[model samples]
Structures are given as C-alpha cells and as structure tokens.
Target chain A: MKSSRPPMPQLLEQVARSLAARKDPALTGIDVETLCAQLRERPPPPPAQPRWQDALIEAQIPEGASVLDLGCGGGELLHRLIRDKSVRGQGVEIDFEAVSQCLTLGVPVLQTNLDEGLREFPDQSFDYVVLEETVQTLHQPLRVLNDVLRVGRYGIVSFPNFGSWRVRLSLAIEGRMPSTPALPYRWYETPNIHLFTLLDFLELTSEISARVVRGFSLVEGVVRPLGLNDNLEADESLLIITRDPPLA
Target chain B: MKARLRKYDPPNSPTSVGWTKAFTWRLTPPDTPWQLECGGHLNEVTVEYETYGELSPARDNAILIAHALSGDAHVAGWDRDASDTHRPWRKNKPGWWDAVVGPGKAIDTRTFFVICANVLGGCYGTTGPRSICPETGRRYGLSFPKVTVGDWVRLQARLLDHLGIERLHGVVGGSLGGQQAIEWAMAFPERVARCIVLAASPRLSAQGLAFNAVGRYSIMNDPLFLNGDYEDGQGPDAGLAAARMLAHITYLSESGMHQKFGRRRRVAHGPKSGFGVEFEVESYLEYQGRAFVERFDADAYLYITRAMDYYDCAESWGGGDLATACRRVRAEMLIVSFSSDWLYPRAQCRDFAIHLCRAGRPVTYVDVPSNLGHDAFLVETDAVGRLISAFFNPARKGWSI
Candidate 1:
C-alpha cells in the first residue's frame, strides 16, 4: 500500500513545531504552584448560558437522557445538561478554540468534522442528538439530518429562521439578502449556506420520510409550542424529529 | 519554584526527577487476596509500586499509572543508585515515560499524586509466574492462573484501598496498560474520575492475536521450556528471546523499522550463517530480544499477552453494546491514537471515542501523527504528554475547581 503519511522529513518538522509550541518545556521541572496560578489567570469562562442558548434548551429533558450537541461551542449547552438535568452529555465540534473551551469545562467532545457524517457512532447511540444553531452552516445538512435520525432516538435541531417577517421586510425593501438579529452575517460572508426557514425544514423532513414529533418556536429568546404563523413570526426553531417508522 | 539542578547520572547526564526517590508497597499476609479471573486465587500479592506527590485530604488527586506489557512500576524517575546501562542503544534510561510524568510533566507529579505499580502478572517485583508460590513452594511458572486485564485492575484497586485512597483522580496507561485503565473505569466506575487511554483498542485485533500466539508458540516449542516446569535459572532463554523478537515486530511499523535500521548489513567484513542474522534489522531485533529476555519472564510475557488479547470493553458491561459498556464508566476519557500504530490503529481508537460519545460519556480524542508505530505511546511524549496534562488540568462538567 502507498504511504498515507507525510515523508520522514515533513513528519519531523511537525514534531519540531509541537515541541516548540509546548506551553512549558520543563516536562519534568516546573512546579505545581506556578501551573495552577497560570491556569487561574486564564479568565474563568462564562459561568452561565446566554438567553438564546437557555431558550434553545428549555425543552424538558427526561431523567437519565443522553444528549449530543453538534457544534457544541465551548460545550456550554452540554455542560448545562449535566448540571441542571443530570443527564449525560457529549459533543462533536472541530474548532480548536471552541474545543479548548469545552475541555476547560470538562465536557466530553469529539474534535471531528460534523460534515463527514457520524459514521463512526453506532445506531441510536444517544437519546437526543442536538444540532443547535449550527444546521445552516452544514455542508451536507440532508445527509447529516438523516445520520442524526439514525444515530439518535430523537434529534433536536435549532437554527435561525430565514423566513422571519423582519428578514422578508429587509429583502423586500432593500432588495438585498436580509440580515437581521437571527441572520447576523451578510450573505457573502455568512457561514450559513443552507439558510432555510421552519417551513422549509418541515418540508425537507417530510421529503426525507422523517417525522417532526414535537416542534417549538423561539421568538425574542422566548420558546413556545409551534403555532401556524411560527414560520413568519419566530426568530428560530427547536424541533424534535425522527425518521418515520417503517410500515409493515 | 524551580527544581535546583541536582546530581545527574553518567552518559551525558540527561535531566532526572531532580531527586532520589523510590516507593514500594508490598502486600503481605494481612493484605486482601486477589481473586483471579481464571478461578485461581492468591492470598498474598506483593505489588512493588512507586508514588509521587501527596494525596489530597479528600483522597482525590491520585492517578494510577498502569505500565505496558514490558513496563514496570518505574514510570518515571531515578533512585540514587539506579543504573541506566540496561541497553547500549539508549543513554541515561530513566523511567519508560519520564518525559510525561514529572513535576512539570503532563501527568505532573507536583499537581496530582501518581501511583504506578508493577502489574499482577508482571515480572517487575509483582506476584507473577516467576514468584515463588506459597502453596507449592515453587515458582508458578506456566502454571500461573490465566489473568485478564480485569484481574490486573482488580489487584490495582486493592493497592489503592491499602493506601487509603477511596478514588483515583485519574487512571492512565498506554497499550496493555491502557486496557487496564479502561477495565478500572469499567469495573469500578465510581472510583475513577478520569481515564486516559493511549494507543489501545477496545478489542484485540485478529492480527494482534496472531502475533501474540506466534510469540507464545515460539517459547512453548523450545525444548528448554520443560513444560513450564523447568527449575529457576535453567529455563529456556533462547526460546524467550525468539518470542520477544516476534513481539518486537508487532510493536513497530514497517516504515519505522526501515527508518531505524534499513537494509544495512551488521558487519562490513563478517562471516555469517546463510540463514541467520544477515541484515542490520535482524541484529537489532536480536539485541532487543536478548535484552528483553534478561529483564522479563517468558511465563509472565505469556500471561500478560493473554490478558491483553482477552480484553474487549464491548463484551463485559455492554453485553456486546459499546454504549452500554460506556454507561458503566463515570470517568471522562482522553483516548489517544498514533497514526502509524497498526497494532491498535487510529480507526479503532477513534471508534472507541465515538462509542464513548454514543454512551453519552465525556470523551476527547487526539491523533498524534507518528512514524513510531504503537511504541509511540511510550516514546512520543511531547504531544501525548501535553494532551494528558491539558485534559487532566481542566475540571469536568460536574467538578469544582
């Protein structure tokens, strides 16, 4: 088989880079007091969840439930689950800064690309696979959603609504891609390539033979059961969806 | 406080733990007996162990270090008279993972109390096949009870209990040691707060089993084996050497071997037997085998390799369920895999991390790209050490600083 790794010289260079980048070279000499003091100065991370984050997780989680947070930035949501709901929490995030933040909080996180598909995990491994505010940025949303349903008993997805009335007003008046409180980035720079509304999500789920078991809408950081006008009124959505059961 | 540069050993004087220290805990009569995995039992088990740092008042901050197949309690450090001339290839050989477990090391001794013990089936002063059996007044030899990674973890726990340590702040091990670390978290989930497993798989690969089996057969086929009944000092050294040579192959990668030895001949002008020791690789392997047999027990090697082969995290608490097996562990895990480790490949280690996630356990996985094969877990300490230190220093989701 062909070599899957870099040549020896390149590998040595990589090793050299790591050795040089170590926080402390005194692998056996530094004192504990100095290390602990250095750790403390690293400003304590935010102690509580933001309003939007709290609203996104307001849905009741059953006791002993297991949750996986996709794009679990700093693991704030998962940490909250372990603390308040007393459930197990896991995360899949790729960003280094975010992963380090998650590590500092002591959250179990897989530093892997979500877009590659959750092929590594077994079927229905988690009670709930949560994709909060990260679905729009996904390169393969349809495939990821399908994998989510397959890997989790229940998949909870939350994302900013592209169909909000404010978004429509901006697009209608200015004739440019809308940027609102939800869609905070300009169209050219936004990471959310597949920005779709609640109606679009529901239609896509149905198209893929999945069922939305319980759907809720969050408006101005307040979550409530989904209403007919939620597609136009709600700023975001939190939907508990699953693949439709096979018919006999 | 900086560690004042103290005395150094000969051979260029590499930095040491900066002091002379040796800790031993030998379990005798009053000590609790360890029930074996194969139905046999030992009433008294002597566990030669070394400790670093002071245990916290809450008995936390204790990290149990499980050595690999050939490793001993000497995880890192050098006693005053400890010699480093075991091998001609290495200079000032301190502990196996000295770079990763010192004062400012990843498993920093200054911040966390560390305890590394010679495993039950180990030849390093632990009760092994070479130890005299109290019942028979003879070495157990090949008759040593079949032990598993689970058995090793059980005995290691007793060591903790004897030390008045109710729980381990973390448990860390590489290769076979990693298997024991996993078993510790599984068998006694409440006792371990964190688990660091390096270059290990949940289940032994078929290739791994094949290699181990070959090693076993090499020793058994030797006439000097004497059916595992040979008297002490008269045992089969050649057979043990052959077995170790076989095992050493599995521990390294083809690329690594090529990088280290290549096709160079051992002698420029040499008379050689046509069928033996032609290449430099053969000479290297032979030297490793000879050196290994001197420091290890053939029977102990047999026992430990068997223990490693029998390990499968999915089989026990999970009942063929990875997630279920994971639910049995409360410790957050840092699973590391080397890129070139064919013995326990990166894919398997990644799957382990995935399984832990599936089980809803907190887990982190770091891939250390290397050409060092499975042995990288022991030698490639720079990145691995940093990962461990970073993983351990942070408090878990429920833990308070």
Candidate 2:
C-alpha cells in the first residue's frame, strides 16, 4: 500500500527553509573547524567526578535488567549499556532522523514524542525508565515524570540546577536568563521553554508521591548528596527517584 | 623478485583512478560476528581505513583518530603536488579536521601514529553503498545492509589487530568519531587506555534527530534518487546539496555567523547582484554544499546518517539505564563539551558524566567555555590538546603540580 507521507526531499526542503529563516542569531554563523581547533589547544579545567549516581544504580539494578531511554540521542548511552553493562534496552524519541540513526546503530528505538503519551507501551514494561536532560523541554514535566514512574520500576532524572545561586544571581542581577556552560542558550532561543530549579523538581516529586531514592549534585564531575551544608552554587545536579511504597 | 614483479604487471599502462583510493581489511568480531539487524544476516564485512602517520617500533604510541560525518581518513599533510585536486582522503580543499591532526599540533605525528578510517558507509575508500557488491557486480546503493556503531567499532578492532597492536594509548574523536570512541571503550575495554569523547552525546537528542531527519528527507526526496538506484547522470544532486547545506548550518554557531557574515552584501563588485544570498553566510553555505557533492556519495550519506540516527547505547540494555552501560568500562574517560555548541551541548556531556559516575566509572568531564558551538572541539585545539595531554599523563594524576 502506498503511504500517505509526503516525499522526503520536499519535507526536508520545507524544514530547511524554516530552519534557515528561524536561524538563531546566537547560533547561526561560525567556522566550527577553526573554533574546535582553538578549544582543543587549551588545558582542560580540573575534572569533576560524580560518584553518587553510580552507587545508586549499582545498588538498584539487578542482573539482566530491561531499560527504556527517553530521548536517547545517537545511542551513545544506550550502546554503552549493551556493550558494557549487558542490559537489554529500548528508546523512544520524537526525531525521525535520530530514530533512523539508532536503527542504523542497531538500537531499537521507537520514533514518538513523550509529551503526546506512550499509549503504545503497556504499563510497567521496563525495569527502569531514564529521563536524561529531558525534563526541561517537555511542556508537561510532571505528567512525563508520572508516566516514566508508571512504566519503570525506577526512574532517573538529571538537569541543571536553576536554583544554584549562580543562576539565581544571573536572574536577579543580570536581569536575563542565565547562560552557563550547562544552559548556554539565551531566553528567546532556549530549548528549555519550561525552566525549573532543583528544589522545584523535588517539590513536584513529593506532590506526585514519588520517593527520592537518592539525589545528588555534581561538582566538577564529583557526585555529592544534596544537602544544606553543601554549596548549591554548582552548575549542575542529578536526581534519582522511585515510586513510593511496595508494589503489591 | 623484481623481474617476477614486473612480469606480473598489466600490459596496458595503468591509468590512475584519480582523486580517490580505497583499501579494505577483513575483520572478525571478538564475540559473535556482525549480524545485520534489518535482515538478520551474519556477515563478515571489511573495514576500509587510511593512515596519516608512520608507525613506530614497539607500536605502543599509535593514536587512532576517528572521523565525523563527511570526514575521511585523510587527516592532514597531504602531498600538494598529488595529481588530484581533491586529495586522496580529503574531498574539500584544506581538508576538514586538518586544524588539529597535523605535525606540531595536538595530535602531532611526531608523538603518535595516526590512523583514520573512512567509516563503513562512507563514500571514501570504504565498503559503502557506492561499492560494487561482490555477489552482484552492481553497487549496493540502497540495498547495502544498514551499519551500526558496533559494526564500525568491530571493523576498527580488526584494523588494530591487523596492525598487530594489542592496546592503544588513546582513541580521540569528535561527534560520530566520539561515538566510535565510546564504543571502543565499551566493546574492548582492555584495548583502550584513554578515551576522549568531544562534543558527543550518549544518545541522539530529539532536536538533533529532527535535523538529521530533515537532511535525509532532503536527499531521498529528489526525483533523481530513483528509489536509491540513480547510478547514471540522473543523481540526486539537488537533494544531496540541500542536505549538505542543512548539515553545514549545524556545524556553525550564530555568533560565529554574525562575526563572519552578518548582513553583508554578496558579490560586492559584480553586476549580477541582489539580496539573494547577499550575505557571506549564504554564499558560504552554498559553497560548502556545492563542494560537498563533488565527492560524497548520496547513498552513503543516507546510510551513514541512518547509522547515526539509530545510535542508542541504552536501547541495547533494555533497562533504559545509562549508568548500567558504563559499569564495565575500564578506560579513564575525558568528556569535553563546548559552551556554545547547541548541537551537542554541555547538558548532554553532563548527562554522560552523570551516568558514568553512577556506574562507578572514573570519568573527567569538562565544559569548556566557548562560543564556537559544537565545532569548538576541533578548532579549540590548544585547549583540548593540553587537557588530553594532562589526562593521559600518568605523572599528573592526583597531584596538584
């Protein structure tokens, strides 16, 4: 049967035109090769090692676990598990090219937007569902987290902590959206239309009745637990959450 | 022996194929040989790679440099007097990825032997969609089996075996090359001592995939594609060019664009003038697209991009757990991100570090402040070079000095 989809080139042309017209001034024109070379020449900053998430996952995931990766881009993370951890996995993404790339890489990825819902997948289908840097983009972060909690035995959420004093200061003093290395885009062009801080996420998790298995902030790549004593001035943080109580 | 070699030579004067050359080496996987997921076929495929640096004795100093999209084995320092305007390994003049891989540079040939391979589905000297199928003399074209990062990594592993190297000091790559670096550490943890993944992510971002999809759609939509069978003059040049243009845009940053060609009039002296492509940026994009099509194969473009699209490490684990994937990775990893690179931003690199830390893997993450976007990894050589040297330097570990 002939598919009803438009021809690929025409669709691409339309998208190309739109992209060109809507090119972000902040991201538009630069010689990348030249710039990349320059960046490579400098000494890298001190390494930041985050160890908390590693401990939590190791303690939680049993042998031969099934995983579902939301917004699995380029299969880097997914491929890591398959080859290193020996875990079975699947991914869902809204981008057709990404799904195609995933398929090319031999990853099983379904091309679908999470915000639209995952009716195609049955409830409790995966041992774990991970949302890596995906919370900020969703129009409804709470619903997506709820759905992720429902589908997997455990959930992992990681995002830049907007509550960090640096970000808050940028908002308070600079009077503009913060553009840290973690969140580089300006207010008008930011992909994160729905911004939330680490504390905001915790409150939402509580309202949804999700229990925080373990949560920590990454300082210079080192994973440290989120606490009042610790400095919240760091740029990024990761949170690992689970459903409350025991499943009957 | 010389007389015997001469006797075996062809009667007619050998005509140089000109501009391009390819070489392939058969590779057997360490585990269960490569199986094409699309058709479930067990296949023994050969990886075609090219070399830029001389090998040294002891062979412990080899640095395998992987290429990103539209890049090949021709790292740099090509013979300028070579017959072809387009050097054997590089298509565009001056060559892409040349800024960092030459002598006296970050990946200095004096220190490390560099070997770069045209990826499995690449148009350059590699077994790709353009290559004639052994079974059916015709090119595989669209019929070529889909390839994955694992497939590429397996091929590279074979290349390493062929070179008689049991272990590598480091594997450096950006973008897709970065993906290959990640796979190398995962697939053969013992083989790689240090890995540098630059401006690369653990998986494809939805935004990134959307861009890739549009690029592919642009290519496949051309009527000349002829369902992937356009072998003659009627090729999908327009679509391919459009795809290249779109991809070229992603490689650049808006700040860079503004700095280089903001609202500038094109052909300032020419009578054939208008607002169309009046800015230097538009002309640059056109030039990039036009130059790209002169060498790249449309089918290979489709296949390779598809491979990138399908890349997801977590999917294979079935648990959707990125941390689990890194549990077994033994190599010390250095993940770098550019502040300006929206394509594969710092957020993605942070995500990778988070998972690696969660898996109890030793990883160093650096978010370099730069407005160079994703391309910063290539051009910011001085910065990246120092980081790599320090990271790999065993003497510098744990000591503030």
Candidate 3:
C-alpha cells in the first residue's frame, strides 16, 4: 500500500526536527546536587509481561516439541516457547535488530529473507511452524506456505483478511487505505508489502496440495469457527491450520 | 595538571607509539580499598577519567559515558600531540564514542560536561589486577581483587562525588558500557536524569556467560597463564589471543565474517593445504589479539570478564523481577538493540523496555536495522548518533538537560 504520509526518511527527519525544537525546563531546571539526589531516590520500574500470543502458545505447544516461528520479531514467540513450552523453537527473521533481540533473549533464530525460499532449513526440521500476522507481508505467499509445509509437519498461518466486508466497504467508500488497530500504520508506512484475501490463500493451498486441519475467524478479538454463513468478508482476522502432503 | 608518566617502561618500546604519547590531566581520588566477589582483596584503588566540555557554574550539565570492556577514559577530542592518537574529538579515530560526545553530537560537549571513567577492573589508569601491589610494590597480577559490576558502579559514584557533581545529565554506554549505564540508573536513579542502554541486557544470558567462560578458560588454560602470576616476563599471550579471537567472533555477524574474510587467503605461505593460519580472518583476529596483548593485562581480562559473568541486576534487588528492580527509577531511558547482534538480542531489550513500561517509567525503545552484529552500535554512527542526540536534546520537555 502506498503511504499517505511523506517518505520514510522525510518523516523521520520531521520527527527529529520536532524533537530538537523542544526545551523542557523540567529536564534543565534542576541543580546538579538536586539531580543527583533525585537519581538516587528513584528506583527503576519492572518489565512487561507477555501478551495473548504467549498464552496461546503456552496452552497449545506440547512439551519438548520443535517449532519454527516465521517473522518472529525480536524472538518473542520463541521466548514464549522456551519459558512455557520448554520447546526448542527457531525463528526466521529478515531484520537484523530483531535477530539480535532473539540472541539477547537467548533463543535460537536464523536470519533469512522470507520473501525468498527457505532452502536453509532441511525438510521436516520442525513439528510445527507458525506464521503469525506474517503472511500479509510476504510478496509470494504460496512459496512461503510451500516452504513452511516442507520444513514443518503442521503450519499455523494468520492474516488480516482484505476480503472482510468492512475492509471492502471502507475501501469502496473512502477510496483510502483502512487504518484499524489491526493495521496501525498508514498505507505508505505499513509493512504489509502484500495483501491477500482468504479465498486467494485457499486457492493457493489447494494448488499446493495442502490440507486444512482447522479454520477460524476472529471478530472483535473473539475466535469462532468459520461457518458457511459466517460472512468472512466482515471478519476482522482469520487463522488456518494446514498440513503438507506426505513426501512423494 | 600534566598526565603522569608511568614509573616503569619496558625497553624496546615502539618509537612511534600510539596516542599514549599525548598526556593531558590526571587525578588521584582518595584511596578506598575494597574486597572482590572472589576471595581476593585490594588495599588501594585509583580511578582514571577524562572530561570534555565545561562544568556549568551550577554543575548540572554533566554527562557520564561508561566504556565497554576494552574502553578507556578517552571519550573524544585530541591529545596534546595534535595528532589523531586520541581523535574522539577530532574526525580521526573519533575517540571510541566520538559519535555521541562531540560539540553538536548527542552528548554535546558544548552543553554538557562529559566524564568517562575507565572501570575499576580496567587495565587503563584505573587500579586493577595489573596495578602494583602496595605491600610488595610489584604488579598485583593474580593477587588483584576480583571486582564486580557493582564495585565498578560504586567507584563511578565515588568519582562523581569527588567531582562535586551530584547529579548527571545522563549515563550512556553500549555492550559492557551499557551494563554500567543501567547500573548507574538503577543504583542512583535520582543522580541521573536519563540513560541510554544500547546492546545490553539486565543479566548476562547463559550463552553469553558460556562464551565469556570459554574466553576466560582459553586464557587461564594457556600453558603460559602460570596461575595468573605470569609476571616472570613470559605471559599467556597465546591464550589471550585465542580468547580475544573467540570473543571477537561474537562481536561480529556471520555475514560480516563472510564480507571481511570469506575464506580469503592470507599473504603468508605456510601449510596452505592444512588448517594453518591461512585465512585472512585468522590473520586479522591474530592481529587484534596481538595488539590487545601489547596494551592490555591478562590479569585484568580475568577480573573484568569474571565481573561481567557475575552481572545480574535482578539478583541485587531480591527476587529475579527486573521490573521490581527498576521500580524507583525517575530517569527517562532509551534502550536500543541491533538486529544482527546475536550477543544481546532484541527480545532481552524488549523485556527491559516492557519492565520499564510496566514500572511506569518513560522509555524509548529502538531496534535499529543493521547486520553488523553487537558491534553495530559502534559502527552505525549516523543512526546511533541521531538517536542519542534526540534523546539528550535539552529542549525536550521531559528530558531537557
């Protein structure tokens, strides 16, 4: 999606300029002695706990299982596995900082460009592979799915559905990219390099000889089974469980 | 005050010595000996530091830059020689932290009086395992106290007190330097207004500890270690080199290694068919190790690495709750992590940020995109400098200093 805002560099420069212009006295008003006293008096704050994904992985992952988490930003998903599942999970990321974050967390992660093929991992390297909110960002969704199927016994893919009637209506009426909490950034700034519909994914899966183990839609953060009359065109999110065909 | 010359100098010193030729100023803080986590004890300790910019009349504009494991107190600017030996201030070597400490840079010497001190267990001017023992008047060697991160923080606090600068604008560092920065904010939150922690963790991971352990083991197991008292003229240069090589590998990324060496052959011709020092990477690592040995002490390496291994901020508070540990911090913080740095990855940094956020502290977290590995913070000068400058900009309402 083309961003409505200025280019990334220009936006960053603007932010920097705005920050540079401010002169808050609270930071500058204190005397050295007073500041030292203040520093000694104040203690540091606590760390944040994991969110919903952590809970989901904890409840679902079997003990001692090997998992592959794609687009695992900062290795948070792998950390959840290590802490809750005691599972050894590897992550694939394109961003260097996110990989560093994984290392700092002490989780094993491989740096790979997801748009390309996953030739790095041998076939069936993982019992389960998860692609969380990552499919929409891929330029070649089928290639990723096929690769995941090759490396994992089971695959969990989640994506925001452009086929949702709300999104369709928004686009039809507003003629501008929709910006919901699910899709926080403007079109030009969004990392959703490629957007796909549920039907498109299903078609790709059918062509790749993958079988859907389970399918569900999430609306207003509630997960429910997808029924014939479910009207996925209005659902906010979708999750699919698929299995790759046995070798040969 | 002129920089003091070392009382003893070994013969055959290189004629064109590096920056050490330029001597500026020095100060001897009051001698306060202390014990280490290890059984060793030190009777007297001295800290060496350097300052840039001016201390305002009110002494409120002081910024402290903590050095990494191998860093000294020379943060920026040139030495007396006017050459590029200490080019942190000039555009030369750029002083290890020149990006963050120059006139218009993030730390901005023009506005903030910046002080960078070599850690307590450092081989620099500070007293460490390499310093002379007062009782025997010989280099302490193995007899030096095994210091901890806490001890280093305490010494820094003492230095601040001596300077009569009660509060700091902020404490900034990356890698081990980041450890010191976090400790300063936690230990004396009221004394520091802000903290910039880049490529650091609340505690050293087991993997990190393991790497450090192997590095230390390499040095200690060297036949030449001689139980740490290798002062008989011969020392564990081989072991130290091996340790440096291993640790250096961690500092860089796989891609970086490929780009730097990529199985390229060295100029030397020997055992080309076998596993000799044929790769350029091997030669480069050797050069790094050899250069390190010339300026560093083996005993100091043991103390510092041991101190790093023992670094666990959660242990200091009570339980292993990092958020609880930082509950009292009033300082704003900026926690930065690099993408390719497998050493201190982004998840740990995010955890730090989450904890800070949970504790209701204001913090800005940036995961910079880079493939330079842990060393990215030092090499990605433009991005880091921009973040630091923005973080420390005095005009910002919440963090003007």
Candidate 4:
C-alpha cells in the first residue's frame, strides 16, 4: 500500500522548490538530489514463500513460548507467530532494511551476522529455534544446527530439496546448474553453499545424534507426511528435530 | 559564520508552527518541597515549557520531547518574545529542534501534540542555579541541588500531571535527551507507550567522564569565576567559552572536521602570530564558544554536566545488570546510533539494544550510516525523522518488503 505521505526524495524536491520560489539563500549551493540520494534506501524485494511457514503455524506452538528466528527476513513468520500463537519472538537478521521492517512490525530484532554464531543466547534459552530457507546459505550449516539444538528445545529447519525430480531432471537433461522456482539464482551468484536433499538432512540429524521428531514434504503449497518417495517427490522439506527423545 | 548555522522556517512558512508562547508550571510549593537524588529539597520549583499542536480528546496523542544539554523549552515555532528576551540567540531561529517538529515535519506537530520543557538546572526560564531561591532571596548559584536524569523524568511526570495527561503516546529525544527517554521508559514504563532514543547509550564512558571533568575544571578555575557566585553579567565567561570550545571538538568526527577545515589558514598569508585564531578550525571553535557563553550560564553547566556524568542506567535501574534493568521497560523502543559518533560509539549503542532484546523487550536498533558525528541526531533530521514517524505510526508504509 502506498502511503499518503510523499516519499523522502519528493519531500526534498518540494523543499528545494519552495526555497527557490522564495529566493532563499539556503538554496544557493545545496544539492537537493544529492541529499535525497543519501536518504534513499534500496527498495526491498518481495518475500518468498516456503510451505514450512504454513506447517509451523499448523503445528500450533504453545502460547507464550519463546521463539528465536535466525535470518528472519522482514520478520513475516515471526510476526505471524506472535500474533496467532502469542509466542515471545526475537529475530536476528543481517540486512539493514530487513531489520528496519522488523522494528516497524514491532518485532524484537538484533542486526548481527549469523556467521558469528549465537553466542549471546544461553543454552535452551528458547523453546523453539527456526531456520527458514536460510540453512543452505550458511558457511557451516552443521555447526549452526548443533548450536540451534544447544540453544533451543526444538529446532525447526526448512530447506529446498536438491534431489527433487524437477531439479534432478533439469541437471540431467539440460546439463547445466539447475534453476528452479525454489532455487532461482545462477550457480555463480547463488547464496546456497550446502544444498542438500531431505534424506541428506535426515542423515545430518543422525550425525549430530539428534532425533527427528517430525518431518513434512511440501510441494506446490501442499503439505504431506514425509514418505519413502519424498527424496525425489518433495520440492522442499520441513524437519522438527531435538537433542532429547520425543515426549510421551 | 552565519552561513554555517542551519536555516530556519520562515515566519510564514506553511509547515512552520509560527508564533509560540512559553508557559510556566509551578510544580512544587514551599510547603511541599520536591526531593532530589542528592537528598536535597527544592522549596519551590517551576518549569518553563511550550507545546505545539492540540491534544486529542482522549489526551493520548501527546509526545514529550527531552532536549540536550544546551537546548531549551522552545522546541518549535518562533518565540513570540525572542527579541525582548535577554538571550539574543533566540531572535531569528525558530527552535533547536525546529527541523523535525514543525507542522508537517518528522514529529508532525499537526498529528501529535508535542511538549518540550527547559530542564532543571537550565538557564532558559527554568528554575536553576540562576533562579532566586525562595528560602534565601538570592540566586541559588552553587546552592542549587544536584539533579539527575531520573529527577528530570520525575519533574516531567509532574508537569504531565498538571497538564491532565495520564499517559504519553511517545517520548523522543537525542543526546542527553535520549538518556531522558531511556529513563522515562525504565522509570515510568506505563506512562510512555513508545520511545525513540537517538545517539545515546546506557551511561557515559570513562573517557566521556574525563572530558566532562576537564570542561568543568575550566569553568571553576577562571580568575573571574568568584567561586560561582560572581555578578549576573560577569561570571566566568572566558572559562565557560574555553570549556565549550573543548567540548565542541568531541561533538565532531575527525573526517567531518577535516572536510570542513582541512589545514586552511584563516588569513591566507599571515606571518607567525603569537596566539590568535590562525587555523579555520580554531576560528570555528572560537565563534562557537563565544556564542555559547552568550546564552549559557557557567554554574548551570557545572551542575548539568555533573548530572550527565552521574547517570548510569544499569547501576541505577538494574542493580548493575543492563538486561535486568531493561526488563522494567514496557514501551516499544527504537534506538538509533550514528556511524561516526565516537563520543557515544555505535558499539555501545548496540550493546544497549542487545540487553533490551535479551530482556525480551520490544526494541528496534538501527546504526544509521553517517559522518556527521554525535550531532548527527540533530543535523541528519531527514533520516531521524523518517525512523521516528515510521516507529510511531507503524501502519504507514515507510519501508516495504
């Protein structure tokens, strides 16, 4: 929605015009365009969708549960959690514009690079730690996963399934780095450094001695229980893992 | 020198608040003396304040602004008695914060009723060292009780009560004013719904305290200081000016200073002079110091900067735990720090935000990229205004994703 207020650049221009009309000395050598350029922030990109958000919401986290969202771009999912489930939500994001949006949405956020690790949070400080569509982009996905398990009772992770039929077919037939809707960036420019399939994700959990409490296969906005064929059928996967055994 | 100062809103500008009048609120009577943090009591207390915009029927649209050390209650609009007042500095300029507090500016006086008051121990018609004491018919001078940021908030709350405002929609401030905003949140969380703190931290660093000490030393040691009891027109002007000149350096960035006056000789071809303003930067400081001495009181400077030196949010509010103290704040907060403000570094501001978040408080921290130094909060009005307007009215589409 467009605001009734003029954007900052327009306001500057209006001020300049008014000053010129008055022949005010303040307008003598000032560059309104340059001032406007300094104030302008790059426009934010539209948020993408991954069905894990829907699945997470469907899981219905207990009221007032503490949640920590890593790489919470624009804080959309966290905002939903706080509004719908009454969970205490905090966000960590590296993007300046995204952090500003989170604050505008009344989300508690810290602007710090996730590569530094979550050293600020104590063990089991949060009831749930969420990593959405941001795992493959990390330098050490396994180390972050371990830290997530250490800092939260449950870790909810969502990532694109590289073994999906479409991705595999494109790589096999086209003989080029695959570009699907989920992973649209070219190989040279892609942020995903550790792309893995659902099976690979399950193997990672076992490698860390973590238990998969639940798993879901998400395809074209439809969510289903993880099945034997999910390694190739699922376009994306959402896994709920924990260091401790599942509660009775 | 005149060109260096900011341009003010014309008397007839549509966005200008136009003519404004100051009001005095007698908060404390002789019988009911107000208590101070130092265990001193004020027999009589008065606060000079000004308000712009109309209060909503519900009285919920009021935003209280706190000013920095050298600021006054005249936050916006042309002071009606500027020329009549002793302080000639107020004659032409609208107000210190007129940039963001006009009719359609950042704080948007048209939408929110804004109130700003001259702080205690200030010379701007507020009860201070210069005001005649009720108990002793003479100027308080050095007899004035010490004031803290907490005391300022308490007195402001009384002022609000007098105005019949049970709660504030927001409290906004920069520099020392920012500390007041933080104090308001922790001291009276329920009173303020939102707070915007620009270019401030939990407390003054050791280095900051040292610099303040030197400024105070300069004032007290002036040959004409007369132990802070000199005549009204003759007390420590030289001392105060020197102190101001020294402080002026801290408020600027190295790069900003270099850009404005990069080894430029004022005379262009002057042989070695004994001791005068030869360098452009020195000339700039001399003007600033002289201008500051014209409007500010030497005794009040000692008292106010002492108060600033004493402020420590963690020690006062949280038993020395910032996160614990932050737990007391219920208001949504927006903390802004400038990139080049070495006086209150961005890292310190970040730590403050971190503690607030650790306490599970709703806070938005932004380190705005600027080379304007500590004074960026005032100079970078456009950026600061945008953040404040967006924070106050979140429904407005200031940033999209």
Q: By lDDT, who's the top model here?
A: 4
Q: If scored against the real structure, what TM-score would every candidate get?
A: 0.72, 0.57, 0.60, 0.85
Tens-digit lDDT track of model 4 for A1-248: 21122234454456556765787653344454553453354122223354456545436468778888899888877787777677788888888788877866777677777777476677898999988888999998877888899989999888889987556535643346767767778888899999997878898899998988878877655678777777766778888889997678
CAPRI level of candidate 2: incorrect
Q: How good is the docking of model 1, as DockQ? A: 0.25
lDDT of 2 by residue, B1-401 (tens): 01001111111213211222345676555532556545433344556665655677878878788788877776554324334554432322333455565555556666677677878877776677777776787877787888887778767877888888888878988998888888888878889877888889877798889889999899899988987889744689999999999987887788977776776756566555455665577778887777778778788888888888887766643256676678757776777777788888777876775566445454555666677777788777667776665554433322110
DockQ of each: 0.25, 0.02, 0.03, 0.16
lDDT for each residue of candidate 1 in A1-248, tens digit (9 for 90 to 100) = 11122223333334334533584342223333442343334222122224364445645567568887788888877777777777777788877567767777777778788998487777888888888888899999988998898888888888888876546534543346876556767677899899888889999989978888887887655668888878766787878888757546
How many residue pairs clash in model 3?
49
Better of 3 and 4 by TM-score: 4
Candidate 4 per-residue lDDT, tens place, B1-401, comes to 33376677986899999988999988656425989987998888889999999998999999999999888888888887877555678787888888888888888888898999889998988789999998889999898999999999899998898899989989999889999999999999989888988999999999889989999999999998888788988989999999998888889899999998989888888977669878889889999999998889999999999989988989889999888899999888888999999888988988888778777676677888888799899888888887787788735322111
Q: After superposition, how far is residue B33 of candidate 2 from its true place, in Å?
A: 8.7
Q: What digit string (tens of lDDT, one per residue) describes model 3 on residues B102-188?
A: 666667767888888888777777877777888999878777767888878877887788889999888889998898888888888
Clashing pairs in 4: none
Best by TM-score: 4
Model 1 chain B worst lDDT window (10 residues): B1-10
Candidate 1: tens digits of C-alpha lDDT, residues B196-256: 9999978889999998999888888889888887776677788889988888887888999
Comparison by DockQ, 1 against 4, better one: 1
Q: List where candidate 2 sits over 4 angstroms from the true fold.
A: A1-248, B1-34, B37-46, B52-57, B79-82, B85-95, B267-275, B394-401
* Candidate 3 deviant stretches above 4 angstroms: A1-248, B1-31, B35-41, B81-94, B267-271, B399-401
Which is the leading candidate under DockQ?
1
